[model samples]
Target: MIKGIYETHIQVSNLEDAIQFYTQVLGLTIGQLDEARRIAFLYMPGGNKTSMLGLWEQTHDLQTRHFAFHCDKDFILHGATEFLQQNNRHPYNFLNDRSSQPMVFCWMPALAIYFDDPDGNQLEFLALLGGESRADLGVLSYADWLRHTTTA
Candidate 1:
């Protein structure tokens, strides 16, 4: 039986750039690099050396992908946007309202912000929130989520 995701792979235009972005900016640790294969393996922070990500260089007809990183609530709420902006990454919510604010998926009750890598692959920072599922609410700003949580 499957327990959880241990690793995921994505195609990148440049392996070295992708490695730098994931390691220097996102703080992942390099697990291995295969120069002959143009692939690099990286370990997620605090993943207990289990979770991994693979980047494969593809020059022609490259297809981008999306993925999310688990993060702390405090970091997602108070620091994610600023940290991303400081690193020249533009954070946006699911609504695409042109704001760097995190949004809450009422169903999962999780807060998340989206950004793109150099190759236009969507990346997300997500933190699960503590509350009852509100599937009817869909996606909304963190402020709206807070308001509804208090009033309900």
Candidate 2:
């Protein structure tokens, strides 16, 4: 049976720059590198071998991709948002709205903040809210989500 996502690959124009982004900015650990083949492997935080991200240098134009890292704590997500902002990086919503705040996904009861890498790959930090499943409350803006969660 399938357990969970193990790894994913994406194309990059440059390996060294991509390495810096994934490692320094996104906080992934360097796993392996093949300078000859222009391939780089990145591991998620906490040294989890199960999840990996592969960056392959390609000369051809590659389509941008979107991915998310699931987090379990609200503070971490919030802190990530702040960190990104402090670095002059902006965060956006699923709608591609750059509002500098986290969005509330009522369907998943999750709070998420979205941003993009240098290659324009959309990345997210998300956490489930309330610690339980609930009704689908639909997508909401950061302010609205805060109000709803507090008053619900």
Winning candidate number (TM-score): 1
Across residues 1-152, which tens digit of lDDT does each residue of candidate 1 receive?
A: 99789999999999999999999999999999999999999999975887999999999999999999989989999999999999889999898889888999999999999999999999999999998999999998889999999999
For each of the candidates, the C-alpha root-mean-square deviation to the true structure, in angstroms, is 1.0, 2.3
Model 2, 20-67: lDDT tens per residue? Answer: 988888789989999999999999988758799999998788778878
- Displacement of residue 113 (Cα, Å) in model 2 is 0.9
Q: Positional deviation of 63 in candidate 2, in angstroms?
A: 1.4
* Total clashes for model 1: 0
Which pairs of residues collide in candidate 1? Answer: none
Off by over 4 Å in 2: 131-136, 142-152
Report lDDT per candidate: 0.94, 0.79
Query: What number of clashing residue pairs does each candidate have, in the order they appear?
Result: 0, 0
TM-scores for all predictions: 0.96, 0.84
Instruction: In angstroms, give how far residue 151 of model 2 lies from its true place.
Output: 5.7
